[model samples]
Target: MIISVLAAAVAPGAALLAYFYLKDRYAPEPISMVIRMFLAGALVVFPVMVLQRAVVLAFGENPFLFSFVYSAGVEEFFKWFLLYFLIYKHVEFDEPYDGIVYAVAVSLGFATVENVIYSLLDYKSFSQLLFRAFLPVSGHALFGVVMGFYMGKAKFHTGRPLGLLAVSLAFPVFYHGLYDYILIELKRYWIWLIVPLMVFLWARSLWKVNHANSRSPLRAVYSEDEVKLPT
Candidate 1:
């Protein structure tokens, strides 16, 4: 990838993610935390990518079904593990809104690496890379957004957290499976299904965070000194 084209493709999303990490300017993680989150995501993704490939091989010609399995079952599972083990109990993860930002950071980090692979391996031109970068890349981030939102809810609900977490995972899996089905099996135009579903998930997560938790990511982070991060 040409350096300039790569910058053009990555900059917008990076900036957007950073801005949100900063909490629409309300509160932002330390730049180092932001960078750490990004790296955590990228580093974690390598193994997940390998798992995706292995699962693909197992499914062979029916790549889409296993594609769904890999994406929902494997990739999201690790990201969730990252959030749970590292982010969940941390001081940084205190507020409900914190969930959305950290989740997005992790997801975007994965997306960033995934983007480079797709760009370098799949595309011949910078423009093609730039165009496709926005959608699938954002898709990954948004998928995390969905997962994070619900996670925040489950963390605090205490009343019925497991059910909430289950829904959170199930919803994303279904959404992810549908998205892959469109792109690989059914034909990509059906991807419109992905957009609306993503929108709904985002909206739902935000609603839960805003109404249920009512704290920003910044406050959440600072709040964690007492909370101890989950191991």
Candidate 2:
């Protein structure tokens, strides 16, 4: 019962926290926008999850292969589509912060459903639940922030902002790819390699996001005629 409660609260809260954390210097995203992003993710994850499972089953049970193609590929692909396609085009996406906000929303939506299901069925102890609630789940949110921060900047810059936009997409795909690669492929005794790697990659991503964000021009998209960028 406690796990269920904690998961429900933290899962959604984590998404909000990510929005504020990245939007540190900006206004919070409107509640309506957040809710819409969440709904999009909630609806989209089903198809992505189904494809992931199917690919995993077809390509053999090798942990490395499964993590690379199925888990990392499908999951990241879905999230990317939601961000770059649906929400990226929204009017709220005017600010670079929008990228982070919506990205985290989608990620949390995925995490929330994942957390509730795991909490409902998995270990009974608070410690066990907490571990799942915080680490992997929270990690997922942070990763979304990491990815969103860049996507936002990219969107803001009109694709010619020193190639930062490209970096944003590439970094998340690589970072997330490495993360799942280590966890799912848990057979090797030297799996500890992923730990330091995650820390390093995450820290690097944070630095890149902050540095780039500081330069994001504070411009209003409300009055300016809406300029559409090719997705």
Candidate 2 residues 8-109, lDDT tens each?
545554655554454545455677778777677667767877887787677766766665557666776687777777877787776676677677788777
RMSD of 2: 6.9
Point to the candidate with the largest lDDT.
Answer: 1
Instruction: Encode model 1's per-residue lDDT on 1-231: one tens digit a residue.
Output: 367656755665696586556553335456676677778988987788787788778776475666567676687787788887887778766556666777788888888877766765666776676566556776777687778788877776759688877765766676667666666765746657656766776676456545534544454565675488565
- For model 2, the local distance difference test gives 0.66
Q: Estimate each model's TM-score.
A: 0.79, 0.77
Position 51, candidate 1: lDDT: 74
Candidate 2 TM-score over all chains jointly: 0.77
Local lDDT at 83 for model 1:
80
Model 1 clashing residue pairs (backbone) = 22-28, 89-229, 91-221, 91-224, 92-221, 95-220
Indicate the TM-score of model 1: 0.79
| Clash-forming residue pairs, model 2 | none
